[model samples]
Target: MNNRYSNKDVDVFAWFREASEKGNAYAQFNLALMYKRGKGVRRNDAAAFVWMRLSALQGIAFAQNHLGAMYYNGAGTKPDDAEAVFWFRMAARQGDASAQQNLGLMYRKGRGVPRNDETALTWFCRAAEQGVASAQALLGEAYAQGLGTKRNFQLALAWFRKAALQGDASAQLNLGLMYRRGHGVPQSDTQAVAWYRQAAAQGTAAAQRHLGVAYAEGRGVRVDLERAYSWLRRAAEQGDVDAQFNMGVMLSNGYGTHKDEALAFDWYQRAASSGHMLAQYNLGGMYAHGRGVRRDPAEALAWYRKAADQGAANAQFNVGVIYANGHGVPKDEACAVAWYRHAAEQGDASAQNNLGVMYANGQGVLHDDAEAVRWYRRAAEQGHPLAQYNLGGMYAGGRGVERDSVLSYMWISLAADAGDETACNNRKLIERKLTREEIGSAELMTRRWRDAHRTRTV
Candidate 1:
């Protein structure tokens, strides 16, 4: 009698029961599968385990692989990684492809044995060579990331293509990334979108997120805010952090949906809770400005601090401002200086300008004109109008260096050109202190500086 039955026929069940009870290994394995799947028999994990173990003991490689899965999943018995490894090894030694893949997974995850990438790669290679799609994908990732072998984008692409053709979602996602980044293939946003669509169709959250970004940025297709919102919502619903952040931005700006600050706040809160730095910073802004929630400076500071801890320069600057202005806490210039310095060292123009003020006024440190000039120059070079005006004042007073009326006039004129009203008035006052030649020289310097920066930005 055939061991496998296609239908839930009563006679077939009886025949399998009889043969299984009579010590037929194939019949036992088939009966176990039927019980496990609730096909010809009611789903009974204990019965499945019993029959599977019996068949496995009879040296059936397939039964051994199934038994290992049962133990690993705790379907019929307490989860036991060691026992799972044992059975998986038994079937693997018999050249069972599934068993080899399972063993590789165990090694890769350190579930039943010491985490060993080399061993995992070895087993994955064997199973991949035998045409296991998942194993092929795993091997591809290993090669791409140099996990257990030298990084080889060509080999990774080959393996990913093999598994992707077999409809592996992970392989398709990786292949899309490879194309997007030009790894072992010419960069092609269109090809990246094609593979991303394939993987997204299979419900891969990462691929959905990528497809959403591609739509939003018009990389591979025409800019489609509606489609971007749709794909991002799918991935965000699946708990993708980046997608959640993007959803917040879209909702806030009414990109594809109606403008809804409340919804934007909720999405930002979700992503912020997940440790997304940008989300945290945005959430702080929402709280501080009463955009979607109550205006709460304390809450804003809390969120800003969280992002600041993650090295967000904007958040650090905000934290410094909050401390300096006593927005939600006691006014502490020392704390403000510390936070400002943190952001300043990271090249935050606003923070650098603020730090210069703190130093010049001796609010947090001893008054140091030279130190103030140093920081003001850094921010001024970045085209911060306020810093340029302040640096010009330093030159006019000779606080940091020898007084130079022409240089001071040039800096003040640059600030005035950038639309600083105070600088504009100050430039008029400074013009009276210069000769015709000095004024002409200052104007020429200003023009040269503006042209150089304009060219650099272009």
Candidate 2:
């Protein structure tokens, strides 16, 4: 590969043929380059392979490495991995850094050799010591992941920095992640963004997406929706699924660009087809509301089911609603209960409230006031307004537990504070039932509950 070729209109082909006939290895390599590149010769991979093999037999390390690559890639010959390993070993023994890195890759992948991380690490180290950028990146990953070495974040960071300084895009991206996560280095969003920008400029899709998110969220930089959209669009155009979903959200919400439901739906569809659960959920809502596409209950149900299967709580709740309303599917109270339970188990407050309603009315589950109160209390603790109002009614009527006016007032007042008009009206009526001391106790209880819930959320 390092051999020089004359391009001064000389008859280089004739000169190579005469020198090759004299058994000169360098001349054979030059002739092979001519055949490979069609320089002063017709392009012929077979001829190139033949001449390279001859030079490689003369112990020319670079020629041996080229021959190995040709065999490995089946260029001008049928693929022969074992033969490629043989040639790579020959060149690697002569201190060819490229061959050493290639051998390390083969050993790591167990291609034509037993998988041996230690051996792979040894070869990688050899190449890295010689300043091979790719080998340095691989060494960094190996150290970081504890592959054939003890996990060493500092060493990993050092190696990544070396490769990044040499313009290795992957290393730059990994270096950014390390800085973002404070692995071996102090957490610094500014440093992370700097490295991400370097990799993003080199067309690293993941880096572009991360950089876009950082810009949009004002992480280590001023919030710039336009810049975020630009970076995310670049990554999305490259078929990054997460970027596609993000682009859909931004477009739909008009975050950094004009609101474009049609474009948002397009991106959501692309991501949904790739099995992005959130995209499926969003696409289902779009279909349900006729936002960007024709309103179609059946299509909406189909998308919701896909997301629900992936454990999306909102999708599960939507599925329950569709079944209960008989929209696109047969009205099945049993199916509604099943979907609602699924969402409720995942802590969906709306689903919890709906489950309580179902239990209280015997619509889906057995009529059990105790179960209803239990579900209502779960939702109310999460600050669900409807559930708090419902719980207040239960406590006042003694439907599930003994009547406690103070508890009833506390629940209703909490709901009322959240702007529930019905609860606000009921609280005033309940206020007349309590003594002055009871009202004070109820108010104190509501404040304590609010503080506890706020702390839990934070």
Best by TM-score: 1
State the C-alpha lDDT per candidate: 0.94, 0.93
Report the Cα lDDT for residue 205, model 1.
98
- Residue-level lDDT of model 1, residues 210-230, one tens digit each, is 999999999988999999999
Please, what is the TM-score per model? 0.91, 0.84
The digit string of per-residue lDDT tens for model 2 on 1-458 reads 22344554137887897899899999998888888887776678999999999999999999999999999999878899999999999999999999999999889889889999999999999999999999999999999889888999999999999999999999999999999999999999999999999999999999999999999999878999999999999999999999999999999999899999999999999999999999999999999999989999999999999999999999999999999889988999889999999999999988998899899899877898999999899999989999999999999999888999999999999899989999999999999989999999999999999888995420
C-alpha root-mean-square deviation, each candidate: 3.5, 4.2
In terms of lDDT, the poorest run of 10 residues in model 1 is 1-10
- Runs of candidate 1 exceeding 4 Å displacement: 1-18, 40-47, 455-458
